[model samples]
Target chain A: MRIAFGGNQAGFWWYMAAGAVLLLAFAGIGLFRGAVPIDEGDVLAVLARHLLPGERAADPSVDTIVWSLRAPRVVVAAMVGGCLALAGAQMQGLFRNPLASPGIVGTSTGAAAGAVFALTFGLAGTFLLAAPLFAVAGALLSLLIVTRIATRDGYTPVTTLLLAGVALNALLAAFNSWLIARSWEQYEAARRIAYWMMGGVTDRGWVHVGMVLPGMVIGCAIAVWFARDLDLLLEGEEVAASLGVDIEKTKRAVLWSAAILTGSAVAVSGVVGFVGLVVPHLVRLLLGPVHRRLLPAAFLTGAWFVVGADLLARTLVAPEEVFLGVVTAFVGAPFFLFLLVRHESEVAVSR
Target chain B: MMETRGSARRAPRLELVDGGVERRGRWLLRDVDLVIEPAMLTSVVGPNGAGKSTLLRLLSGTWRLTEGKALLGGFDLSALPRRQAARRVAYVPQTVRPTFEFTVREFVTLGRYPHESRLFGTRSADRGWIDRCLDDTDVLALAERRVTTLSGGELQRVLMARCLATEAEVLLLDEPTSNLDLAHGLDLLGLARRLACEGRSVVLVLHDLNAAARFADRVAVLDGGALIAEGPPAEVLNPDLLRRVFRVEAVPLEGSTAPVFDFEPLR
Candidate 1:
């Protein structure tokens, strides 16, 4: 047990360092890569000297691409990634089911529904915050409905929760599609909606970061603060009660926090799939299930993952810009499948 | 020593009911009056569904009496906060099945929740107590092992360790050794006896009459939710009462500490 605790602490620190290193490397790659593909020499010259028109021989085009577009995209991607993963972790803890995912549970679908409605009706043009605010409200409402229905008789069984999420997601998807069909005049709006739904950091700015920052901070803080209670809750309701966990109160707090983080990520970068579902499990596998360590570590790793994935999304099909969600699911799905196959015994044990 | 002082100062555990209803319309337990002493082993035993578990739940403050007061340590069980009751009485359910893989240490540390300060992480004393509890229950060696992987007997020990970590003098166990082998069953009974000897009050529900007669200082028999017999095992285990309640011809053998029952074969 002592060794396991020590090992957990070690793993947590290692993940934090690795995440930081990866983010730094991605930021470097973002800075140096360009139409001319500036190498380390050019990057160094630009950094050491201002590299003005007459001062030094470094590409200004590279600087502009690196500092302006690429930098903002990376930051926003990191923020979105962290938010989604942290939200997922909190949701998993909230529902006490590892399989619980924000998108699968209708939060993302609700956000999509709200966003498509906003775009189709020109609400974004009418109001500055209308798109995000409506999306947030919709996500919260869907989550509230799910939570209410799942917990009608005091406790939420895993199967009921998963089924409810699937049903709600399907329902919301239908609404989103209907909204798109009705807004035929807004052809561009439909295309943009589809693109956003696929998720990207293209043309993202510091404004996106500013919009999501507060929600992420508040939601993640709440997740960390209640991590202990979540750990107790994993033991089940009766055991949790015996251990002094106020299940009802904690349940409300967790759902609220998860909704905020998830909605903010969706509102900021559109629906990025599988980040929340995949990241927490990764953290759990590397580190033990103690949330005190798990939440912070997951947050960092998620940020790195999102930023890295965004980098790949931008560079993979250069000039075309592959969707962030597509790449994430492409990689995440296989990993998740492997995890499902490998952890079948564990899953059976939990059941 | 503090537990002894606390128990000594504590008022007798009481159950007062105007009307406490059960699952069925039948009043399993009516307006009952009972007082339980501290630092003693009290066994609750009866036929299946005699409301023994119900009374234990009421006493442990898990379930509130519908019309009357259930008191523990001079506080109304219903009115008293769950944390407060948990600090005084540790409850162990019959079946312990954790849905997740919780290590033994992790499971035991849950008992320290009521004791640990909210803002501060686990204190040195809390950790010390947890370690001691694990050692006492002989689960220290298995602290790293997942509770889901434990044998029934090992899990029982881990649960007992958790109860001990609660630091509560009053331990209420619902059929703790029901699934255990003979050795494990006797071991748990012995542990309960030891706790009582150490001045910690223990209330257990035992289905096995032999185990109850062997370990409990006093046995309380409930029939249809009412306390029908409450006294020494010798006084309570009579063939007349056994036949009336159990509907079986029980020949009680003498001299043995455990009540050996020989049923006359149906001819």
Candidate 2:
């Protein structure tokens, strides 16, 4: 069950170095691999010019492509990926289940329902921020309901939380489907809803980056601060409480932070799947389960995964972009199956 | 180490006065009056559903008494801050299955959580205590191994070491030897005795009557959520009480420090 990744200290640094290199490489691919070809040298020149003062740009068009169009999208993708993966890791630790993610607790579906509702009612068109705002609202509301239902005597049981999440997911997904069905008569509305449901990072600009960055930073910081407590909590609720962890408080804090992270990511990226579920599991498999290491490793790995997946989505079938979620699932589903098999055998051996 | 030895001068006297717990419209325990003094090993023994574990929970501050109050070191148990109370009392349950892989050292270091500052790293004093606990429980050799890879006996000792790492005056252990073999069980009990000898109060919930008689300085028998008897092992453990409370006949072997009882059904 325990996959030894070299030694603990040296392996951790090595993974960090490798992950940083991979992230930069993927970010480079994301920046330049589009319909309009931009040279890597040109991109670097523009970046240096922007950093320095009074430097003549090689080409304004290239600068625009790198800074105005591609940079924002790439940054947004990284932020959303890091946010969801960090949230997923926190959820797994909070529930003490490897399978737990933002989607498991209905947060993603709830946000989707909120966005769909906003779009169907024309609220999104009226207010530019309405869709993301409503999505965040829905995610937080669902988290509150789940927390309320799962809690008894100030303690939230994992079984009760999961059951509540399942029920809520069913109800929210049905509501989303109902909204889509009701708006089927309108072609434009139906198309928007359908495309949003498919999930993508295309055309996301600096505003989208701004919308999700604060939550990502705050949530990741909070998660890291509580990483030690999460390690103790994985043992069990009673053990954590006996070790002076305010169990109820810690659980509530972690759940809410996850909701924030998931809500913002879903708002910007439109319900991207598999990144949150697969990235954390992959990191834990490669590294060990210590949250101090797991959290940062998951964040970097998730950023790389989304950027790479987004690049493939844009380039695989030239000029016709594929949905980001579709590409991630195409790759992540088989890995998920492999993880399940490995997890099963690990459990068997441990038992 | 010197700090702990010096602070050991004031050993807390844990007392329960008319303490009772009710759950789901039923009383799990009531009118339980017991005093746990320092430097003593007290064993609570009864058949299933006798509220032995519930009493330990109450003492550990995990459960609230619906009536009356329990006091730890003269402060009401409910009034103490959770971290402060945790620093005073440590509780070890029957078994804990960790979902993540933590080394034995990492698992034992959790015991020092209450003593460390919230934002800072581990205190040097706390680290010393953790290492001492590992050495004391004879788990130093297993410190680097993953807890999941440990045997049941090794796991129990590791958990015991964790409890000791807290440096708490009182330990509430609920069936520490339940899944352990006879030799491991005796080793755990002997460790408990050693803890008591070092000015710590150890309250153990034991299902084995002979082990309780063998290791406990005091034995409290619970029947139907009430304390049926509380006294020294020789005073409380006897043929008549065993027959009355446990519905068994006790055949005591002679020439032992504490009588070893061989139970036969009442039929």
Candidate 3:
């Protein structure tokens, strides 16, 4: 059953507006709070100077820091968060389970492995967008394998798909381990792989922003296009089929859409934990489970969440920044568990 | 508006010609030939594991038929695309575990899917038909409620509302009243009869023999994965057949339009 309505029937209206404000606030904080203690007005001035074709800000250095240094990370972080959350919502609808995220199904790790493979083999150095391309390819290939293994007679049962995903994760982990061992001879290669495993975008640039933009735009568009069909899918395959949904086509499209979203996000952000798993689920709890509203709401909620988390990562422990994945896991895990416990008890009480 | 559509809504003739499903060298249902006519309520009564659901699936063109053909309007049912077939047939499965927080109106609106295929279709296009469907099932009052918050009987009515939104000719309901109180069960059966009276072919998979005898214009009995007997309730649900197939003794009520069978297991 769906998570019980959390008593706020009007929650969705406020959520999007709140999300927009919080996202800008977090991003604004990110711009001003770094190595140089620039004022929030100065950051806005820098933005207005560049965006509105006005006079240069008082400090050229602050302009460089805000525009060149902090802005890319903020944009990339939003894209990563939005894509991951979109993927999460899509997978939950596709698999018909609240807990089925891209990370849980091994797609994110597979993409991380793909990026690591490119970086280790010097493919990323040869080309600008190679890492994300490889990641998308890896994601699609792994999803195809998982879907192939789980489907029988044109139907993919949920339990079997989950089990197959678990197995795929184990196999990918082993393969990555072998790759890391192979790359151990070269210190740079090993460090790059380890960096991808660590899951962050500390020194990320505009190139990284460009890498994940298509995945976010194309994936969200495709997912939202199939939003109605995904709603039908959550009902069941038989129900979807009876209602004019081409079951196999819808499943394949949704899987690919989720794969692209997770793959590209992982390519830039590495294995950012819980953004995909928790953001959409939480948004669904606050909003309803209808995919059209759910997907976009999840995207905004996730974007702000990670941007906020990035700010916390920077300011929480000054001088030494925490890993993005670590911050997300620390904050997200407990709240997810709280939701689980509350949902379970509510379910029991209703019963 | 209902009057205009009512005249044009004649249900197509559906026929199963030796059609059934098989799995791994075992037949779930075998060689079941039956003609379902519009303006009739047909109840399928059988003992447990007697393939009542399999028959419904075959009739609905869900499970692939391993034997012969199911025909609609003299064309093979399985050959038609599910979208086109859905425009003619709608099926309600045995158990509907409400999974989402969709309002009853939105839930029923999903049934209009077959008629629409646009990336950004007009949302209010099918509003009139949806409201009429809600009215037909008597759940128009509950249209604003979340489906997950509804009672079992209310949910059943909402499901029927969703099915009616399809405007399909044939509706196959699998044990629609299994969990309801007697009044709700009778009410649901009466609603099924109303659909039939409105020129739709309504097939119900029911375990309640007395309900079958009372409500069904025709009845089909199944035993051992085969069609054992079929005809009007009086002829199909006879005492000897009930004793043989269900091993129960059945006696008719004194004054009833149909034979209200009182069944007791044979000693």
Q: Best-fitting candidate, measured by TM-score?
A: 2
Shift in Å, residue B177, candidate 2: 1.3
**What lDDT tens digits, residue by residue, belong to model 3 across residues B29-76?**
888899988778999999999999988888888778988999998999
DockQ, in order, for the candidates? Answer: 0.36, 0.57, 0.52
Better of 1 and 3 by lDDT: 3
**Candidate that beats the other on DockQ, 1 or 2, i.e. the better one:** 2
List the lowest-lDDT window of 10 residues for candidate 3 chain B. B1-10
Ranking by TM-score: 2, 3, 1
CA lDDT of each candidate?
A: 0.77, 0.85, 0.84
lDDT of 2 by residue, B95-163 (tens): 865556777887898888888776674777887777888887788889878887888888998998899
Of candidate 1 chain A, the 10-residue stretch with the lowest lDDT total is: A1-10
Q: Could you give the interface RMSD of each candidate, to one decimal?
A: 3.5, 1.7, 2.8
Give lDDT tens digits, candidate 2, residues A100-192.
Answer: 887678888988988999999989889988888898888989998988888887778878988999999999999999999999998888898
- lDDT digits (tens) for residues A152-175 of candidate 1: 657665457678888999999999
- TM-score, model 1 to reference: 0.88
Please tell me which model should have the higher TM-score, number 1 or number 2. Answer: 2
Identify the superior model by TM-score, candidate 1 or candidate 3: 3
Per-residue lDDT over B1-267 for candidate 1, one digit per residue giving the tens place of the 0 to 100 score = 111111232324544444365544666676666666776788988999888777777777766566677776666777877777778778887775765556687778888877766557578878778888888888888987877678888998888888888877788899999989999888888888878887778889998887888789888888887778888888888888888887778887767867768766333
All models, RMSD in angstroms = 4.3, 2.4, 2.9
Model 3: per-residue lDDT, tens digit, A207-253? 88988888878888789888888888878888777767778888778
Query: Once superposed on the true structure, which residue ranges of model 3 sit more than 4 Å away at CA?
Result: A1-11, A39-46, A53-61, A125-128, A181-186, B1-8
